[model samples]
Target: MADLVAELAAAARNHTALARRVLSDLEAGCRSAPECELRDLIATSRTVPPARWNQLLPGARGIYPDACWPEARLVVEVDSRAFHGFGDAPERTERRRARYASMGWTVLPVALRRIRTEPEQVLAEIEAAYRAVLSRRD
Candidate 1:
């Protein structure tokens, strides 16, 4: 951890005041950075992995998400049927979905094919999901 801090400090000092800004962001408990570069193609506020990342799944400690809007408790997890293999027991999937809902999340699962071929549609749907949750305050 010390080594990581020293390296980050050096890298930040070398760049535009981003070091201090990054440090501040970290100190503010913003760890577990985004997992997907798809963030670059979308417009949103700090779409990073959740702060309470591990809690994303009970009895699981490293449930790092792909993209999440912490304020809205919305997460967009990318799935690829070709790569991940259609391999989850129906009961397991049901339990996981129930846990996510209990955790106050509006989880959005997006297929890799849709993201690669129809990015605009995916973005729109993501934006809509975020907005829907944001409006739940009333």
Candidate 2:
């Protein structure tokens, strides 16, 4: 059983790496018009996960976000339908979002379909969320 579990873990890790690579490739090819404010930010950013927030909230499990744009006061979560709403994922996501909100961070949940079908729109929403955070900060 232990060996089986280990193998499953390895497979999960491999799959995650592949997904990240695909996202990176897609992001790299993203083009923005001159009027878009988030082009630079989105283009330069790599995937930002929750481990980056460990200093802010220690000893938190399953609390990692897809991306954490600290300067922008944003926490981006990529919600794939299969992984979401299964078991306790919904509750877990809510708990994490609340925790981040308590720390004055704006949470942005982006669906996988949106990432694939309307990346530009997703980027726009992220920019708007960041802008809202800035406005609140001021």
TM-score for every candidate vs. truth?
Answer: 0.56, 0.56
Which pairs of residues collide in candidate 2? 48-67
Give candidate 2 misplaced runs (Cα > 4 Å): 1-41, 44-62
Residue-by-residue lDDT tens digits, candidate 1, 1-138: 567577776674555466555554455444433323245346343333333322344333445455566788776766555423456644554565566677787788777777778877887887778778888955
Candidate no. 1 TM-score: 0.56
| N/CA/C clash count, model 1 | 0
Give lDDT: candidate 1, residue 99.
68
What TM-score would you give candidate 2 relative to the actual structure? 0.56
Which digits, one per residue and each the tens of the lDDT, describe model 2 over residues 1-138? 455445555675745765444444434332222112223336543442222322233334455555555765677666665656799989877888888888777778777666667777777777677677777778
Task: Please list the Cα RMSD from the true structure of every candidate, rounded to 1 decimal place.
Answer: 6.0, 10.4
